[model samples]
Target: MTTTLHCHMPLPANFRADGFLDFHRRDAQQVAERVYEQTLEKGLLWHGQPALLRIALQPQQAEASLLLDGASRRDDEALLASTVRHMLGLTQPVEAFEAVVAGHPQLGPLLARQSGLRVPQTSSGFEALAWAIIGQQISVAAAVSIRRRFIQAAGRRHSSGLYCLPDADCAAGMDEASLRAAGFTQGKAQTLLRLAAIVASGELPLAAWQFAPDAAQIGKQLAAIRGIGPWTISYALLRGFAWLDGSLHGDVAVRRNLQRLLARDDKLEAAEVEAWLAPFSPWRALVAAHLWAMQSSDGY
Candidate 1:
């Protein structure tokens, strides 16, 4: 069934598409039927395929539908509805709540321009670590390409364009040679393996990273890993999950966006950009999201 919902009189500022798509292995369509599985998925496959859903969530209502390869499954329909309910942040729409905190001396201007900050508690610490390793020193598109390869190799299949990101057991089972063949550089491969080992062995409490006390504490946890640096950690904190206040100054795209937003010289320091975020503490993530939205808006 194709589902749609009406707004709650006061419409939400933003909505999430592909709430489960985040779990997809950017490249699982090629290799196998049973790959890796995502957290939100009900099982490997309703009939051996990744599930695609269209969910429209507003504060008052949400609607989700999945037509599994032309056959509708009520179980899939209910699962889609339930997952969307939890992930959309419709219960609180904390974006509004965070707005109140945005004017603090720490996060004033960034919050001033930002309209929404929806938090979805999904990512595991291991996923964050692995994503951070893959994203280092690369364009978002290039990183996505690499991610597709990595995910397909380790991911379990669900439906089309969806799969689970590899887990420690899944990834660790692969030899370095296998990873290298999938385009992981030796250093990157090593880093990923180490990160997997840490998560798998219980040395790092990545599952608890999202609720970390403050930026400093979160930074400490992230940087403790070998390949994870401030930039990489901050990126994961911001996107791998929804730590809204995390800003990515080292991100070339964000840096360029800031330069454009500020109308400044190319050499504008990352510190200065971060300083500009003083007014938007905790809400900076929303600001960053808006800027990204602007860039992707109108398909520019």
Candidate 2:
């Protein structure tokens, strides 16, 4: 079913799929051709359902029928339209995105590269928190493998290829035996299930969090969780909120990129990179995006 709809949102500035989605979304391997978000709720929200991409956006015509399905299959026309509008960034002012990337040199280039950086805010913070734990001290490939296993076991696949990650109820009963098959270490598996238990019991409000926190506050809250910490929160900021200024203080890649960009050795201190990147305030997320994007393309 195709329905013509008008888009009130501008095309986002930071819209691209340079393998980041490979790690971020479950349907990535077979269905990553169309995924995006607005910058309002942070980049935490993502479009993982195949229904989201079914109706190809007719850019030249700017008019076409939307093929809505997936997690949103049951939604009415109004809701579908709203979701489309939001997805295409028609709801928010493009000006806000401009303001975010206007001044900073690093982010300016990145914003330019990202095409349109509009991502809606609708992330499962707990899922991302779990992801961080699963990924710690592991290669992205290894992390993704482990994650795929865990998600497959717990999450129910929705239409259009979106997997609404399991909530506390589904996760509470997940024992170490099941997770070990998913290739998780016993310790890692225990931490994840325990985290899910707390969430299911309402002891931890993993899904409910705000984006406008001071660094310390964000760090503190995430660290309080058994499996989350500074690096995890920063990651959540990137994957969950999609902050333009979000950068991990000690990320190895961030340091290496900064050093290489500065003609320094590959071992630049995290502090130095932070100092150099501080000027791009509020847009560092975009800066990090650019750096990661660059690495994503040319291994430099």
Candidate 3:
């Protein structure tokens, strides 16, 4: 039986719609919509079950309405709400991060302009891991194109005509050849399939971390997998489990933006970037998000 539920969540303080609006526009999973308010629609899995999530953002009111359609259990209402909150970064401690950056020479002004911005999370850890793998050393546009093809190949269509990102089991069933055909490099294809198998077999336990995050432990576990590195693990933790401390210095955009922020003429080394972000600890990912926003925001 189909079930529908509605939930309302308060937006973060000084919430800017630009990040969410840009994300909604760029996301391959979502249907495009724009009017007085913006709406993002996508198919996702809840406890291995399919459902469609529609989130409407009203920037003027600084609030959002989340609707879940096709849920199998009315009991899932709370869990569904929590998931939506996590996906949209509703629970991000933006104030805390801002406080940490307040009055800073370089970051202060940037944070002022980007007050309510947050990094939108992936629907699942597997999706985050898969995306990190697919995105390694590639431009965002290339990664998006490959991701679209990958979703078409491995994901299932929902009643809403949107494809839900493949769950671990479904992803595990994907062949490397199919992934290669979908534009994944040989290493990336192998790595993704291996990760899916590990997760599907319950060996990796990606879901457990979301509830009780142990970043070091999870990082060690993911690092054991071939082709998974510091950046991949950090990215997955930030996007999947909402573990905000992971260092993203290795990200090209983060470094480039940091260089621009500092008005440096020379390229920065990865170690330098890592050292620069260390002071922000526990909010490193948030800082990285700000750096990303700085690159995206025009007239900055």
- Per lDDT, the best of the predicted structures is 3
Tens digits of per-residue lDDT for model 1, 52-129: 444433344444444353454545544444445444544434656555765554344544544453444333445555
User: What is the per-residue lDDT of model 2 for residues 162-235, given as tens digits with 9 covering 90 to 100?
Assistant: 44455456667778888899899888887778777776777655444433335455566556767665666777
- Candidate 2 regions exceeding 4 Å error are 1-123, 159-164, 206-219, 243-245, 297-300
Separate clash counts for every candidate: 20, 29, 0
Q: Whose TM-score is higher: candidate 1's or candidate 2's?
A: 2
**Cα shift from native, residue 78, model 1 (Å):** 13
What tens digits encode model 3's per-residue C-alpha lDDT throughout 1-300? Answer: 566677767765566666666754554444322223566666666666666767777644333333344445655667667767787787788888888789999999998888878778776788889888988888877887788888889757666667777889888898999999999999999999999999999999987677557889999999999999999999989888888898988888899899999999999888999999999998998898888887773211
Candidates' TM-scores?
0.65, 0.66, 0.90
Error of 1 at 52 (Å): 8.6
What is the number of residue pairs that collide in model 2?
Answer: 29
Model 3 clashing residue pairs (backbone): none
